[model samples]
Target: MTIRISRRRLLTTAAATSIGVLAMPYLSRAADRPQITHGVQSGDVGADGGVVWARADRPSHMMVEVATTESFSHAKVLPPIAALPESDFTAKMLLENLPAGQETFYRVRFRDLAHPAISSEPAIGRFRTAPADRRDVSFVWGGDVAGQGWGINPDDGGMVTFATMRRHRPDFLLHSGDTIYADGVIAAEVKLADGKVWKNVTIPEKAKVAETLDEFRAAHKYNFLDDNVRAFNAEVPIFVQWDDHEVTNNWSASKQLPAAYKERSIGLLAARSARAFHEMYPMRESLAEPGRIYRTLHYGPHLDVFMLDERSYRGANGENQQTAYGPESYFLGPDQLAWLKRGLLNSRATWKVIASDMPLSIIVYDDAANRSGSEAFAQGDGPPRGRELEIADILRFIKSAGIVNTVWLTADVHYAAAHYYNPDKAQFQDFEPFWEFVAGPLHAGTFGPNQLDNTFGPEVKFIKAPGQGQQNLPPSAGMQFFGHVRIEGATGQMTVTLRDRADVALWSTTLDPRPGKPG
Candidate 1:
């Protein structure tokens, strides 16, 4: 756990590191109430305890407290918790008795009566728990950071690759969907018929649903009052999974898009944007009852984290038969696909990961891959739009549930891709090594019109290309690139780095857990 490489001020030779600890927190201004201009967050950590948050300013409930030290006098403090201006004050604090990979320290206080009076000059984080599900575990993923339209600079794309993955501190975080562009807007109303809007794609204005529920809590306070997305919800602890603009465009709860998937008000505005996106992200449900974030996260015996809801038990496509690749159309339907094939046939966990948000390999896009003019594509030779048999029924339930060590980490293609894609022959979906990695939208940058040269025209391609289909990317991980991974289930081995916003590392690769049955 000692990686101190150099080279990186935002370019050239390329190398970076940061994880020394206990020295970089400083916040003065006489003590208290700044309602943070975007800062304070922690999430899903537990070898024992982890999860403290902050968003401050609740019409006067805000108490919340915690400590390890940064001058709470002798901080060990706990037990304040309030913050509820009906949730706009956002706090959370699910702390709980700490001690498991121990590196303890925290900060986030706000009270005038419960007694911390005011604090928040701390933000040094790191956590590691899950140590035995079976023997192998690694976490890190990507998603559409759709915000701040036009060609770039959405908080320096993926928070500069998530502040360079909070300096290589991975244990959890996988959002394979547009985490919220709730109808973004910046490229000036996205016009076309010669109206101009088409340079970088910002399209905002479509979160329509929730005619009541206070306009769905003002669209979840418009991306939790973005301040580099509240400092990436205060540095990691995410598992969120929802695509389709989190509420509009291409929504499918009985349809809406292009011509007519029919029925409107998009299933009560996608159930009020999944209940305001689980009241702002602590996300972890899916057992049923108009809820269930598609559940499954082990991480100890070495890895499991399934996390699916491919748009809530999918089946709604109507606009001229949308088709997510036939077979009675249903993504993770069939009772969570028989509970993900009996939880990967009684798993022991040595790696399973499928926090997918669509794209189990078979991307066509480019206006459905140049139709009318005829190359006659968009998945015809029997697989493309058929979605190669919904990704060969997830690789035939991992070769009839022998459940080796399947791997995948997806995000709605906003740019930043990697693929090995396999279907045996005749482009069953394009052949070989069905591996896919896509990191994105750190703050949302890089889209269309020759996106910084990763050009996807005349045929659409990506495979970390530069020769084989050609992709040469890395003008700072468009959408501000963000993805980092490290795992050592003793021998499962893993590494993926992709960074930006000064903490650079564009692309990386390493994976070895094949598990078997591919012949």
Candidate 2:
């Protein structure tokens, strides 16, 4: 389990002397090279600063050096942070006093406490601080990873979509959900249709469903094994939220797992998954309560990003009838919904983006034999029901408060599409019109153009799914998708583009703010 740092050809006596007495006491000349298994990452960028993350193969003190320039000449080294086993030896340091709207370069190295000079190879990363004022803002977002037996293959470019995404150079990436497939296993090879074989690099922990805390932690670590993902994380800051696969398929807080997971309680599994998630990403802590992931980030005066937590407080997936609307169906819970409403009403940004983990109007079905039910907002075809009642209440509040230019961005269905929900054609028409854009399955199997429940008067404007007679295309085939948004500072307009793995634009549209005009 030790990660050896790659050794240099030589360490001259003069260079060792330059390190001085502070370094001599802990230097281990006989120690082998220490490695950084997972590369460095940065996230939670603010106007002044952000957080940088790294993991070492062994117990060590993580040191992050920050600078305005690429070289170490002007660098300021942060105090050493312990990479403890409590967090699976991962460590993150909050960077401060950085200039606004400027790119900051950082590098991480691990120092073995017993042999301090025996350090891991330095891993370099960069991210831009949030703008001090209104300026053009751009970001990319998608979800679902290493699912349906798809794992990284070195021969086929190792999650190449991530490399494609890195080229866009967005300010950050919002991972909508399904950060890992903890509920599924990865085999050495998967047999697809037409007798074609998709190969993968399988590890012992990922060869079965995650049950123990260590297993869940391993699931999150497995994603970092891809070089493309590591390179992408090194450059672009990420805002992440979780979906069901982090625990199990279509899971809710109240639902019990099938017999296969009978040994471990759902609560226990979720706790482990949440801890692993926080350790792996540099997300800001929730102020309302500890272990909460939903939070808001303001990107200058042009955009406000609200990341949601759908799995934490939701009701069971099968309780989708109209009768379940009041007490039995709880999505986002009461506190989070209230926070979202208040935040939206008070936000003065030109565009308020709800980084939802799942789409609103789509009907997500469970695979139970005797029961028919849905996940997400819409339960019936014509009107607000079940969890949709919660969404309806939020939308109604926004319209009553005259909040304008609110849009929803999500990706749980593993397809890409654009839908316009206009109350002009709806049964429950108390809300203002808005748009919801969906995209995803970053490097997993690609499936479906999901059916839309018309409760919110959703009209599909554009969609890109698998061609006829095909479903769940492998990542190697280049069918993965991601969405990008660019907001114009001067005009306050937003353009959203959906692109395939090759970085070719599939669909693009410009949206202008429309004042609230309730029906």
**CA lDDT, candidate 1, residue 491:** 80
In model 2, which regions exceed 4 Å deviation?
Answer: 1-31, 323-325, 368-371, 514-519
lDDT of 1 at 398: 68
TM-score winner:
2
Worst 10 residues of 2 by lDDT: 1-10
Expressed as tens digits, the lDDT of each residue in 1-519 for candidate 2 is: 112111121111233333342243333452464568889888888776777888887888887666678875445555578887888888887766566798889878888866776776678999999987878999999999998989987767888889988998999999999999998888998887868888898899998889888888899889999989999999999988999999888777556687777555788888888888888888766556977889888777888899899889887776566644545678888888989988887787889999999999877776535436666776767777778889889889888888999999999888899999999888789998999999887989888876787778899999988876788788877889999999988888899999989998999999987644452
Q: Count the backbone clashes (under 3 Å) in each candidate.
A: 28, 6
Candidate 1, residues 212-272: lDDT per residue as tens digits?
4445445445544444555555555666677776765545655534332232567776776
